[model samples]
Target: MSKTVVAVFSSRGRAEQAVSSLREAGFNKEISIAAKGEDHKGGRGNTDYFGATMAADAGDGLSDGVAAGGLLGGLAGLAVGAGALVVPGIGPLIAAGPIAGMLSGAATGGIAGGLVDWGIPEAEGRQYEEDVKQGRILVSVQASDNKADEAASILKSQGADRVKTH
Candidate 1:
């Protein structure tokens, strides 16, 4: 069986490092990240927010264009499908990998509701949502039961707070 491991980071830098370590440890595909987006409006009407924010391999930081909106550093490139979107009560959010899809469809539900689909308890999901709103970062890994511990360890080592598995 698979389990979802979630961790919260105080800063995006730490979150990026955690994700890089996870990728290096071979958790590439199942990892996802969600962070409070820049305090600006998302894509205009009909604009492709998801496609337009593809993270590029721009050395240490995001490429000029992607940085203006999406993730920072190579972390952007590390994510499979990065994008920006607006959730009803959560404002704009920058998300990548599997979570982006969930947020895209969570317009009415917000990040907490989207997390429930990942098997996180609703109360915990709400707490995570509040964390992001307060400028923290959320990193999650969907791994086999046997690998969940390792993933959690990686996250904890990279300075994650409130690391938990569900």
Candidate 2:
């Protein structure tokens, strides 16, 4: 059996460490990380919101054209798995990791819906969405049942808030 683990962090720095820790623990294949703005209309997050920059060898950040409106400058010269995106109702978002695909997959549903689809309870999904909107970072990993405890421990050690299994 496998377990989907989710945790919320207060900042990008901690979020990044949790991701790296999970990877080092051998849960690298299906990790997901995401963040939302905390101040003003849109949160002002720098590129390293996830703690570490993507290695150049990881590929490249995705892009197309720029959108007008929020804090996101646009997806230009970004590291792999990171991009500037706009989430409906949340405005401009700078995200990395697997969340880049979740946000970019559709225009309307975006992260909150994706969170629900990922097996997070609807209420908790909305709470996570709101936390991100308020400048929080979230990391999730799919781990086998045997590794679930270890994964959650890694996240907790890195100051992950509300760490839970789905």
Could you tell me every candidate's TM-score relative to the true structure? 0.80, 0.71
After superposing candidate 1 on the true structure, give the runs of residues whose Cα lies further than 4 Å from its correct spot: 40-74
**Stretches of candidate 2 exceeding 4 Å from the true structure:** 37-62, 65-80
Query: How do the residues 1-166 of candidate 1 rate in per-residue lDDT, one tens digit apiece?
Result: 9999999988767888899999999998799988765543345322222234432322211122244453333554568877666666765566788887777776578888989898888999999999988888889999999999999999999999879999
CA-lDDT, candidates in order: 0.74, 0.62
Q: What is the lDDT of residue 89 in candidate 1?
A: 74
lDDT of 2 by residue, 89-116 (tens): 8755556556667767753776678777
User: Per the 3 Å backbone cut-off, how many clashing residue pairs does candidate 2 have?
Assistant: 4
RMSD in Å for all candidates: 7.1, 7.4
Residue-level lDDT for 154 in candidate 2: 93
Error of 1 at 72 (Å): 6.8
Best by lDDT: 1
